[model samples]
Target: MSTVLRSIRAAYCTQAVVDWLALEIETARPTQFQWLQRTLADHFGDGKRTYIDSIDADASGATTRFLVRLNDDHCRTVDTVRAALAALDQRHTLVGPALVKLLEVSLDFYPKDDQARAYLPLLVARLQTSLEAAGGTSHRLVGPTKRAEHLDSTDTPDPRRTLYINNKLDPLAWRVYYKITDRDQTLPRDQHRARVEFTLQGVGLHQYGINTVDDLAALDFGDFGHLLHFRQFKPLPDLIANMKPELAQLVQHATRRDRNMISLYPFGLHAYRRYNTGKHAGKPRNGGHPELRKHSTHTTADAELNQLVRNRLHDLTQFFTQNWNEK
Candidate 1:
């Protein structure tokens, strides 16, 4: 049998219309509060209007209060996104749920169901920046059968910035986000600038059996290679062979990334060259089927990294088929 090394893109990518979601990201940490605002402004900066609405800090210099306006865009969709390890290669950086939930809140703009509402909870820098160190970052999902705030911007809702799932299958396996700060929005465009402080993340790695500070210290991530794909593909086979139920969800994700590294590249360059070069094989032909097969539907033309966000939005309608309550 001839082998066709296809990109297992679809297997990992999810596409279903979920209509309603109410999320809230609550954090007690002062630095994280500012970090959240900074991240929102940085990611949605290009086409959207982001404003640092307000700030309140205590006398001891704790940034206790914060609000940033992340303008809504109705024409965006995060299709086939690959969540990166938003840690940006920093060991001290705090990652995991808090950052992810805060992100979901800022990027989620559900413009379709203006009448629908849900209360719920939700990056990294351009490349190596980390979100502020945080404690007690959590989220609340409200209203599949209930509603709150009734925060609806329009009857025809807009597309949201980001969408990772809330299910038993994926969990933290899907944490893709972007990075940086855009503070001082009140100044003129040319005068707009803020000092971006690079700090060591106070968070520790809790994945695998490594959770405590000692555990993290014992294992040298120094040998973990800088390539994000290295840890993904390398640890996968072992995770699968071990057949640990606890790791099943993670295994499914790793399997997909393992497939995407090879398959997705074709989606990007294959079609472009086919039309221009008139050659099915972009550069070289393999010892498989002599001719390449055309896809029935050209589903994915997007090649941006999983972390690249185009349009982040939030809406009232629960347009989805699956979520915690729905399931």
Candidate 2:
């Protein structure tokens, strides 16, 4: 799988105050907020109107607050953000960098191999299962966000199509989950492309030490790798099928309802040990369930997928470090 730097929001803070209403009527503030908003809307917004969050006009001065959003509609690259900000700086003749305040960023992971098409859609379920099995919470193991809870509330609709983890637009948090596909398409659709997106906003950005474009450019994926912990799980049936008969039987006996449950390695191991020491005590006690040895699922599926994501994050870091002068 490969990752795309799907979306980014960078803000420019300036002391220049201009007439927003007059500019709206094509009067004043040609090179200030109005011009910046229109240019960014046309360039990265698909010509849609950019929404202003607030406008403060007090004795000090007047200022307008808004977001010029960059999402899936635009090119999926950090260069896009760099180009937009650079344009603003040159157009307005600003002395320093423009749009340097990094508000939010989203990175999308999808299958790069044609062979992995079938497996892409299953990631949503796999990630959800992993979260549930891991005590329904996730935390960063490194970075400033270390020990911060990520999985707060999840939206798992009946008949289960998508999974939204901590999916809200409040308190500036991190939302990580999978998107099945576009609305116009159905399952098993074209390319079967599934996306596991990571969106980190204001507070989350600060937690990751991403306060400015320079900070984002200097990001290290190693400090944030633990955020992709969901990649640890593989399909259950495949794990059982490859296990030795003795160990496989223990796994099957462990799961109360469905022996074909998504998780079997750690969960089944506990059950297997209990059976060996208790009811089945008469039989020679088997050593550990042989999953770590015989079952290659852990090393093959889990490790390979996790590495793919980490590699992609590293690639994004490199992209940010590169100089971008064009849109």
Candidate 3:
């Protein structure tokens, strides 16, 4: 950030304003429970006996699910509420880890004294263009209003895609990858399937010792077959059979309790917290100003970042090849 532009933003972007907008947009998406479950399943690891609650699809095509925390009794109380509020406050001020990583890498590629912040407004405009091309809107509080009061009730739209792709990626707030649902008959970003969803009826059936797929046959769901109608069993059976081994490998890899979810080692999240705290306007362009000394030396060469990206692609290819060869 240049001294001039930095001063301009510093004069305007207050923490409270950033937080208020973040709360509006985040609350508009699928709830945090859904974000955690879906993203964890996709990016982290999945375990058995894990289930999703009945999903009621919201306007953004995002769905809601009852987050089942097994030890619910210990979860309730004043502390949990306080923690949630605090976390939200923190999150509203953060940028995503992946994005910060991108900025740090790009730093080395650009000139040492460059003000990357100047290009940001242009970049964000381009982002809105790309999102519109992909059938999404860049949230605008625009109206035929000359008055601030008119825009107050103007909604911040539900974020419906990954923050990287969404024009609404608030540099001011933590990035939460949204699970977009474009339409009905679309699979939710969450891993809930018709057969696996915990329903009011599913709860009733559970009392009758009908829980697992093995137990499904106990009830000849004659007239009630519509309950299972959403399970598209045709290609999925073969797909599962084919992909099971690779999926097993992925789960094992992620469950190692490592930062391999991002495929990065010695991750910088601890230091990255400084950016969330608003200690620096951005990761130092090239190690930043003297004030940024407390931040970890943040830069990944372009080649290294490229290599990390390619490594993930290669991991996918190799997984398929090795599994197929075994077959």
Give the winner by TM-score. 2
* Candidate 2 deviant stretches above 4 angstroms: 1-35, 42-52, 55-62, 72-79, 89-119, 131-159, 167-192, 231-251, 254-259, 264-301, 323-327
Alpha-carbon TM-score of each model against the true structure = 0.18, 0.52, 0.17
Candidate 3, residues 53-144, lDDT tens digits: the string is 42465665464333332111211222322333334335333222200000000001111122433333322222121121111223232222
Cα error of candidate 2 at position 271, Å: 19
Task: Point out the higher-scoring one by lDDT: 2 or 3.
Answer: 2
In model 2, state the lDDT of residue 147: 38
Question: Which residue pairs of candidate 3 clash?
Answer: 94-173, 94-174
Clashing residue pairs found in predicted model 2: none
TM-score of 1: 0.18
Q: Candidate 3: what lDDT?
A: 0.26
Q: Give the clash count for each candidate.
A: 42, 0, 2
- lDDT by residue (192-277, candidate 2, tens digit) is 44344444555655677765555655767555555544433344466577789998778667654663243322221111122234
Using TM-score as the yardstick, the better of models 1 and 2 is 2
Model 1, range 103-214, lDDT digits (tens) per residue?
Answer: 1122211212211111111111111111111121121122323432121211111112111112223212122122121242453333211111111112222332433222
